[model samples]
Target chain A: MNAVEAVAKPAASKEKRRTFDVLEALIYLFAVMMLILIVYPIYFIVIASFSDPAAVAGGRMWVLPMGFTLDGYQELLKHSNIWIGYKNTILYTVIGTLISLAVNVSAAYALSRKDLAGRKAITLFFIFTMFFNGGLIPTFLTIRDFHLYDTFLVMVLPFSVAVFNIIVARTFFQSSIPGDLWEAAQLDGCGNLKYYVQIVLPLSKAVLSVLALWTAVGYWNSYFNALIYLKDQDLYPLQLILRNILITNQMQSSMGTGEAAVIAMRLANLMRYSVIIVSTLPIMCMYPFVQKYFNQGVMIGAVK
Target chain B: MSQSNAGMLHTLGRIRKNWGLYLLLLPAAVLLLLFAYIPMYGVLIAFKDYSPATGILESPWAGFNYFEKFFNSYQFDITIKNTLVISLYSIATFPIPIMLALMINQMRANRFKQVFQTVTYMPHFISTVVMVGLILILLSPGNGLLGNLFRLFGAEAPNLIGSAGMFSSLYVWTDVWQHAGWDSIIYIAALSAVDPSLYEAAKVDGASRWQRIRYIDMPMLLPTAITLLILRIGGLLGVGFEKVYLMQNNLNISSSEVIATYVYKIGLLSSQYSFSSAINLFNTVINFILLILVNQAAKKYSENSLW
Candidate 1:
């Protein structure tokens, strides 16, 4: 096929010299349409957050902010619990990412070694949980038995190492870092820990960055753990707090009536849009910076 | 006997030599045991009449009482029907991302491709709580963007979130919106790995753009697609509990009550620990069986398998 194409290239080029084609045009059109569909809701939320609550509720606000006001943000910021949620979430993400990365990366490195005794068994031990689990009740029982319920550590400690992540990292180590490198390091009297820390760690920047971003984002957005394990409002992450607000608003809008109902409705409308922005702003801001690494990271992890 | 002894000695020597590596694995092993394996033992509580005072082990045996109760309960048919419907709905939407990736891959401009990819993948990072919140806000019948759009066209917007009929579509489509771009990443990666020379050959053969895609790109993407499809089918029953739980309301409970959410309600809220555990165990068993069967089928039909 290559030889045939090489011989026919000149003739084909002469006939196919049209710069634009219907297919190309259609592809571009589809891409633009999808871009709008994907981006418009997010854009709407941002604009809606700034619009007046009544205008927003009345369907007046669409492409632009209607009767622009910071009242929603003002009310949200004034609520001290949102600040506490932020503080708790930031702490969880930071500490949890570090702990997760350490546990996952080290485990991955160890399992990636072909010479490691019982490597296959160890990997199976981890992967088995992906298919079947104890389900919700038993897991809750175990957490309670460990005395981790309502504790801050319950948020960060339990469920720290993701098996999927470990597998991805292990696959990365196997493919990217050659066996010869480890052998070479051993020849230079570099012990396992030293070699891993100095050489392997430095060389694995892309995977490490990907793992860090994934772990950090997961911890940042997680609400399920907080919902199940932590009952104390003081320890609640931002998602839980936002969730409470959203549910309350939904309840109020559906049930409430009279003057107080009207007031509650407006507040609910404002908070609905504002809370979306508040909860997701940090992650959305960080996404662009990490977008470049995502392709590389996802490819490495997903390929295997 | 000598060879077996030598193999044992080799394993022992390796363990002794790489003690540090074993030490590194210690924390993960311990954590997995405590959190994953220990809870697995808790699944035994399903077979027993679990009492908080007696703990999981000491509870008296109830044989198949809880399981029978769940199978015979009124919630049984509704929950299973809802679970299968939603799961099948989700599976149906799986190819949207593939189509998106194919469209993105077809684009000639590099800059547009990068921008489109970045913008589309952003939603995957949004928390489920926030995602549902956005859905509620945007679909709010009176004041939401959907309502406003309907009004612009001289019609009232249906209460989309409140309508039982719309629940599954809303859930599936919102999921597609949130995850399609992120999911497309793998396909894009797969596409990039396709041999460029194949495209050149097809071009010289006077193949149209559609023909090139049909003959060249589709073949290259099929293996990855099949592997992913098998994996998706394997976990067909394991619909995410978070978003569904968040989006669930009294109006849409008929369509939204999945096994996971039902289990949470029964086990945690209603305190039917044994019954919920039995339900969960049943769900897990079905999922495991499906996974193995799918994996085996993929292995037989295609070269790609998860194993």
Candidate 2:
């Protein structure tokens, strides 16, 4: 279509053309600049992570790493905190995601059923909580009441069943699974559980994968739960570990750090960038695998 | 009954008989009610000063004392103003990603567009603390990369995260750069739904690339845009405390001290739980108001809303 514009517009006008050429050129110029503006920080961080921590902080580094070294990675790896953080985060994401799927899928299946009694009320009860919360303090108190304070389970249990994921999954099931398929299974003496397990589960991986990825990323990035509930540093996830490093860095920098404190502070800053790369690397790799599910066509069974 | 069951039972009949779904949903329903709904009760402490020792049940009601305390504080108006101002500036620039998405959508399918999107989504994965740490490192005066670049151009390099003047702009624009590509996925998804037949027809009717986008693409995207807008407004007051808190240094606290962080400082750091609860209560109320207001606006304008 744009090709036709090039062919036809040339023969059409010479006077409406001068302003048009300049504007088109300018638009292209701005577009390129915007791309650079969006991407430069990520580039800057990656470059700095490989550079000499001191040199990077001093503003001598840019697109290329100056005095390139693996010192940051070495320092980061040596810290038990970093390792613990990684372990806790992985556990949280995996366990949290599994529970999330179980709850979301089962409840969604129940909600999708035409014969299920009180389905509307159940859906509303779930959706209503999303709209109004009793606020954070109340939520914290509830966590305390459950005796989940400073426990690893607190991190995963609170977000087990998200209404949004449930609704999306419910929609996927209701629309994609033909009633005839379930009828065929039931005629062969299969019950609801057996039919769902044998039929619905197999057909729902597309939307399920999307939900799983969403939950994993959410659990991986979660720090607030740790911040409020898990006060013990040993239970800290990667995000909380990184947050500690940042806080300590700020404190050292402010209190007029001695030589050792300066070393710690510099290493902390370097560790921050490297940890960003490390902690985020998992989910970044997961996106492409599930990218196919994030479309209306996929949910609408266009693929079949 | 025997005849009704023996004639032709189907999938619907099986579901009608089975109650095992209750077992499946039982764990999940219990967890949500315990964690999400139950905490809502603690919201009452906003009106009380019950210590952990006293416990919730025995704690006497303070009767609006905390609310009054929050209202009386000098930080009250400033925090509210700053929170709204930051969100306003952010909502103003929300179009950048949207426009970028439109541009990407306009291009014919190619690998370059895919590559551009992947690169843009990278920063969204970076944690808030690290993102701020990178910004501080990259913009630090004598040793930072961007700082040296500015120095090379013969201008004094500014400490971006440290400067009060640059705090809001830096925070919001950095957000745009990091998540712009990721967030644009919805808009791109919406764009894909526009019927190719409409574009083919528009071509026959003599519409240019820009014209087709201006008329069809923009209008087609309205519902998605408005739906997202309502959601965004619902979260207007609930800015990420971690990002803002990490970004804040003494120099920029004047601009970076938002309501969420203020509550954190008072509650967690200062140990004034009641006062912090009051501040948080205030933030939540204002957010509720904005959510309703924005949803109403979306419903009026586009006949779309979250509810």
Candidate 3:
């Protein structure tokens, strides 16, 4: 009886191992499928952008660039407005990120302090806005009333200090920066401002970088504000400008007729792919450097 | 009453002692007041027969007239239904990320896991316009990648972008594609935090891998999942404006027209401020109530809640 039980146990263990192997294989298959789904479109865009427009339109460009040419990129770059859009976008991103970080970090610091007066009420006040706000028309009117309708300040000022960022920053400060450090600073005759700027800010580099990257990315990608506020063509950010180019190309290709129409359609298809690559290239390039920090930052902010 | 008075005085004294902290908070407070709070006052326009010339303050009080109008309008039913459909579609796809995270966690190779994560997360950084453009290019019937694939199969390529019925699927699936990896980060973090001893114990008990995952890992992930689910439901009606707007065309406008885009059109394009404001107010109030209800439900059911 003991010998028979032993043999049965070995057979069962072998069956379990085979099931586990199959399960592992299934998981790998799913992961690979998801990877392809997420990546193929972006890759197709890259190769298509470089491929000859005629080949791309004819559906011959697959897996690799067919009749590779730089005409699409050349056409995009030849439009001088793309460069201005780049410059404007960069300026908005930098200036807006600085302002956002300054306003949000300071506010978060104050809120993070347990002894601050009316902190609960202040926090609620800030959070209430996240759930409710004036609709589009009223916000637009308010911007116009402030005399910031088409000005560069309109891009940076009104939208600074995101409530979500402030909350995350406040949470980071509370959890990470020790109360003992504050006490130690106080013992050294460090005032609140001095302690915040000298001790706390220096210690809070992780949260600061997180906030900076988030704010910069938001500002860089923003188009709605420019779409509504900036009427001046010269002041258009990269996104709004790119949107226009893409839309106009679509309209031109779809609406036109005859030989000129065919040519326009071909160029538009080329421009469409190139514009996507050009607009996204900078952000994509910056992403890898910040990706590790970003994962850590999001986890730290999200977990609590 | 005396205890409350004392508490108030204590807070005031603390504030006086930490005046510099108050100074630190001032700039953000002022910005919040001007942008967030002040715009809330503009919600009053919904209650008025607002006119641009008379301004928001001087506009004649109409007392639910705009609200009644919005409720009675033809656009009301379509927008609300469209919004709910799209949002529920999104909610349906929420579990995809959790499942993906669990699968990724099962990988034996650390290097492969990292590569999978990095590649999948890349799409989240793509701007809305670029994302929409990519979608269009890939789905374009005449010359798209999908079209080419369809041709390979000896089938006609359907106009996915132009089909109203296909709008929700495209929006939801593309959203899953872009965000599944990024959203799975929290779940991955939660999975890693589960005790290693539990897995060893389960192994000793002769538990299969699936059984271990079901009994041990899943239970550990529940609190985080519940918390995230509650938050997602709270913002369910606040369907992202930019992506929907970019994806909208005359072809699929029937399915694509959400409260946000409708508000933009009436409020800004056609200059029907009061009507759009009323529509927006309805949307926000419903969202707020949904948030509260979900938060309460979460608190009652589980230890995890937003409040």
Candidate 4:
């Protein structure tokens, strides 16, 4: 290459790099602004939860907690229903997730085996539910008819068959698990049941954990079932209890009058922030670690 | 005849061989039959005058009476209009995640990209109950953060949560905020699949970054975008019940009352089982038909479809 050509190429590339640098900077600026838009509200809530109710309402608790206090948390913890809600929610999430994983994973593994009979027909049965369903009232009636209404079993048993979970797990099994392993296991005198339990599941930890976390989070957040089916307060989950405190109770408090009204409103406001923190902090804390596995599951599902 | 008999025998042999797999599938099959299929059968109540004491089977037939009632009712137009408006509004903002993914993919700083993604996805894990609660607390005109901001400027905060005009915006925008980062994952996956050599080739050819993104990334993401768009369109009428129900009040009821909440009120709250079932059945049918139409259209016009 001649000197003039070499000089021209380097100059041209330099201009390109300059443009890229400017564009990259703009992208970063936009991302950081978006990040702050999301994170600031959460940060404000944390500070406001600790700040005195009057200071928070008076607009003094901006950058940091002004006249910091723990009355909100103290009040929230004192509410007896919250404890019951927490116990019920933990029980439901653990038991419901176990049931969900058991049914979904087994069905997915069965459907994933190419050697399985009538696979296409069975798969279509599950997929059809994704397109259409019985809607709300009928399902509620079905639950009631089965005597699952207003029971602990109602929270964990009836709604465990998630077709989307089945599809995702099936996709994972089909793509990630080797057919060669099944053949080798069969040669080693392993039956289908033993092979799945021993060989397949052990190798599928990433997908299993992903499914587990998703189901657990789902169960933790679910309240509509409780809202519609259960009348018994004893079986109410955290989301239902939180809803009563955060939304329903706020209305009742606002309708009151005089000094009591003002006090009730202030306490209600304080307790809301605390309740949010209590309900979501566990999930948020676990989110960063479980995020990659979720992405992995999504990637596997998307390959379809 | 002999060949067909042999084929039947082969199928039976496969079934016999896979009895263990069949056993594994039994739990899910039974659950779906109980929860999914039985409810589907119970949907016959829409065509019958369902009395709880008499049961669905013994309830007298109502035929098209409930369907006609729903069609004539004022809520019919209101709920359909509200559902479509909110759904279309959400669909219009569909490009936001694609844009977010493209921006994140363009970032040369890996550390910043990872951090940005982590922070953004955090909001999605916030339960619907907590999310609406946050909306209420932060938007309360009497003493929320927005109220404090307004006070800083010597003004009162607007009644955002109670305004009918603001309801759809509140629902759609908050939904976007919570989900856009999570939704961008699929596009990000698609972008990562683009051959690195393609980027290198464009760079060596002296293409600018904008040009590279336009030529390389956008095209790669189109199929996934179309697929997701189809899926969204399929579920257009199926707006969520929880958030809208929680956010609702006397003030915003005109705008916020969609089909799901309407059915809940009429069926469970009012004890008009047959009428509510009709409305719900209508909604589900529309959703199913729309999905099929969109999937077919996509398959015909392009290469992407759910099937």
Give the candidate number with the greatest DockQ.
Answer: 4
Lowest summed lDDT across 10 adjacent residues in model 3 chain A is found at A246-255
- Compare the candidates by TM-score and give the number of the best one: 4
Error of 4 at A44 (Å): 0.7
Instruction: Report the error of model 4 at residue A53, Å.
Output: 0.7
Candidate 3 lDDT, A51-165, residue by residue in tens: 8878877778889999988888888878899889999999999999999999999999999999887888999998988888887877888888889999999999888969898
Q: Write the per-residue lDDT of candidate 2 for residues B122-149, one digit (tens) a residue.
A: 6776667667766766667755667678
State the lDDT of candidate 2 residue by residue for A1-304, as single tens digits. 8677767876335424533544345555666686787677667777777878888766677678889877778878788988999999999989989988988889888888776766778788888777677666667767777788899888887768788787887787788788888778878988788887878898887887878877887888878778888888889998888776755465356455589877766776777667667766787787777666655423342211
Q: List DockQ for all candidates.
A: 0.74, 0.41, 0.64, 0.77
Compute the lDDT of residue B261 as modeled in candidate 3: 90
| Model 3 TM-score on a 0 to 1 scale | 0.95
Estimate candidate 1's alpha-carbon lDDT, on a 0 to 1 scale.
0.88
Which pairs, if any, clash in model 1?
A57-B143
By TM-score, the candidates rank as: 4, 1, 3, 2
lDDT-better candidate, 2 vs 3: 3
lDDT by residue (B1-307, candidate 4, tens digit) is 9999999999999999889999999999998899999999989999999999999989999999999999999989999999999999999999999999999898766798889999888898999999999998888898888999999999989999999999999999999989999999989888989998998899789988899999999999999999999989998999989999999998999999999999999999998988999999999999989999999999999998988
Error in Å for residue A73 of model 4:
1.1
* lDDT tens readout by residue for model 3, B36-149: 788789889999998889988899999999888888989889998999999999999988878988888888678999899898888888888777878887898878898888
Task: Write the residue-wise lDDT of candidate 1 on B51-159 in tens digits.
Answer: 9999877889999998899899999998888888888999998888888888888876779888888888989999888889889878877777888889989998999
